[model samples]
Target: MGPTGDGGGDGAGLVVIIVLAAAAVVSLLVAFGYYCYIRNKVSKHLNKLKRNNEALEKARSAVEEEEEGEVGPTVVTERGVQVFGFKQLHSATGGFAKANVVGNGSFGSVYRGVLPEGRKVAVKLMDRAGKQGDEEFKMEVELLTRLRCPHLLGLVGYCSDNGHRLLVYEYMANGGLQEHLYPDGGSCGGVSKLDWETRMRIALEAAKGLEYLHEHVNPPVIHRDFKSSNILLDRNFHAKVSDFGLAKLGSDKAGGHVSTRVLGTQGYVAPE
Candidate 1:
């Protein structure tokens, strides 16, 4: 009877140990599942944060590019004129399509374009084999950078990359004064005859532009190529002097004049 009682007790003890082991395995499995669920949740949250950060960075870059009108990094001339990339200007001008051309000159052609910031602009693309060489291009950039007046055409930027030279200006919706004075084969057409009052206003504005360049600014500028075509008008018929490719920097010395070979439009050249 004693041995039987001992055996029964041992059997009961073995059953309790087996049950406890099984319960521990189940508890471990539950804990592991809960850990896996938490890990997956944390991973998803991290991925979402990463995506949001990437999107924000892209937005910031676009804003910067539009504001600066530069690629890779900001490049400004000595006079605070922005420098643009060749690709940027090319894209803006729609690959310099014939349909986008607004004007053609001895040096190159001008195209109307919309910038990335949605601002209308005029791009003057210099011809590779034009008479205007690198010196003229550089002179225009330098002179335009220093000359800033309401009556003068505003220089938006310039591009000089891989032998591609171009100048960017604020778009003049009314086109050039030549178009209004002589409408045949001009850029802006659907316009009626200019009234006496309107003509006088345009003349006065043009005079103001010249006065600003000749008197107001120190070391006056000489618009060597002043002509009807060089005088651009805005949407409100406000005259703004354009085209400084042949501009010469005047001397500040009393009675001093820049002596150079005469170069201007045939009919517009001054007989000095």
Candidate 2:
């Protein structure tokens, strides 16, 4: 009887031990599942945050590019814009005084002025009541800023303030070709005779300048008022096409834009 009781007690103790071991394994599995769930949640959140950051960076870059392309002042800053101050123009043109007057036109007067750095320039004062007015001013400013040919006059600066408008350009020492072709005030003898070579050179240069204006820039530029008087001569007798108030730019196709008002001087106008 004693042996039977001892065997039964040992069996009961073995059963209890097996039950406790099973419970321990169950607890470990539950803890591992909870840890895995927490880790997965953290990983997903980090990935989402990273993607949002990339999108934000891209938006910022695009805005910067637009700003740089749009409102930038200098041509270098923006790709095509040129910005000049009113003060610089005033100082360069001798405050638009009468003593600096060099020539006059239907819409404006030209003045010869010297800059602080000893650079000589010609300033054209635009009349506020002119027919083209703001449109001509805008065209001249836009076209001159992009034009960089050796045969084209360089635009220095301009001023618009208190009903005053002006355009500044490089000074031409010999004046316009018209002066040499037809002298004013009965000074036919005052005009210089053109040799064959000089005449040919002038024609060739004029053609080349027009060709560049028609073919070079992104949008072709046409000098609607091209004539002998509009052609200026420098000290070295080099011809420079000037006065872009009547210029136009656009398509290569004809009939794209037709001017409402007649352009160019008499006898030089192209038949439309």
Candidate 3:
């Protein structure tokens, strides 16, 4: 009888040991996933000055090429990005009327415009001041024109005429994810509360966009300004990643690592 009691105690202790081992394994898997996520965040942020300086050079070269009307595949003119006539966009937006305005930000405003061909497009008009919004404009022009990820926002065209800067993209009917996620308690665009299934689907689509950038692209771009606001949705609630303004260009030389201060939204940056 005493031996049987001892055996039962041993069995109970074995069960506890197994449970502890299982918990340790789960913890390790969770840690590894987080590590991968941080790695995909492009590792380190580049110093503001360096980023700006390099951006200036890139934007300068691109602008110069556009100005010169260079041909062949090397020039942006020959690339997929169409050079929209400033007057056309001006007319489309009804002289940049406030009524057509759909969104506004530090760089400029976004207007819902209808192309002359009856195609609906979103036109981003950057208030050109001290070369203020040129870097972001050029970045989108350069990157979006080259990268063809389906989950990424499509650049329909752009206007860089007479010192005016405008970016035209395929209109996202549903607007940004942020709008739906946190409504103003009035005119909530999407369902009052996004069901778990819908939320998971949006997350999956966004991840696909990031995965394409992280693995498929030649140099592997890193979106430093990743957030819900940048994730736009279509009429069918399909998500597409937008806003390549603050993304990092990770080349072979850089090895996806840079040196500098932390960047991104206050609450969203590496909160691990």
Task: Name the candidate that leads on TM-score.
Answer: 1
Query: Taking the tens digit of each residue's C-alpha lDDT, what string does model 1 give over 45-139?
Result: 99999999999999898777756546532457466766777778878889888999999988889999877778899999997464557877888
lDDT of residue 171 for candidate 3: 98
What alpha-carbon RMSD in Å does predicted model 1 have with respect to the real structure?
9.0
lDDT of 3 by residue, 1-272 (tens): 99999999999999999999999999999999999988766544445667889999988887676456442123246677667667778778788899988788777899998876788889999885765378888888889999998899999888888889999999999999888887773454545466788889899999999999988887888888888889999998899999887777776454557554566677779865
Residue 59 displacement in candidate 2 (angstroms): 31
The 10 consecutive residues of candidate 1 with the worst lDDT sum are 66-75
Off by over 4 Å in 2: 1-88, 185-191, 252-261, 270-272
User: 1 or 3: which has the higher lDDT?
Assistant: 1
Task: Tell me which residue pairs clash in candidate 3.
Answer: none
Cα error, residue 51 of model 3, in Å, equals 52
Preferred candidate (TM-score higher): 2 or 3:
3
Output the worst ten-in-a-row residue range by lDDT, candidate 3.
66-75
Q: How does each model score on TM-score?
A: 0.70, 0.63, 0.66
Show how many residue pairs clash in every candidate, following the order shown.
Answer: 0, 0, 0
Candidates by TM-score, descending order: 1, 3, 2
Cα RMSD (angstroms) for every candidate in the order listed: 9.0, 10.0, 27.9
Clashing pairs in 1: none
Candidate 1 accuracy as TM-score: 0.70
